[model samples]
Target: MFAARFHPPMASAPPLCRRGVPSDRPAAKDPDAPNPL
Candidate 1:
């Protein structure tokens, strides 16, 4: 059954990445702005 397959304790979960950086909002007409490619 599905319940038996996932019944193990979840204490071994991997750590999550939380290093988010704040970005500046570029103007709509900025010719030198980097493309979001």
Candidate 2:
């Protein structure tokens, strides 16, 4: 319940990172590290 605000920022962060400008946004590293394929 208290995490409501975090949820939106979490979703928005990834898309913004993909825009290329935020290439250094640590969040992007998490997804790529697990999918070595």
For every model shown, what is its TM-score relative to the native structure?
0.21, 0.47
lDDT of 1 at 13: 35
lDDT string for model 2 (1-37, tens) is 7599899999999888687666655556767776664
lDDT of 1 by residue, 1-37 (tens): 7666555433223221121211222443253455542
By summed lDDT, the worst window of 10 consecutive residues in model 2 runs over 21-30
Task: Report each candidate's C-alpha RMSD, comma-separated, in the order given.
Answer: 9.4, 9.8
Cα error of candidate 1 at position 35, Å: 35
Candidate 1 residue 8 C-alpha distance from true site, Å: 2.9
lDDT values of the candidates?
A: 0.36, 0.75
Question: Which segments of candidate 2 are over 4 A away from where they belong?
Answer: 21-37
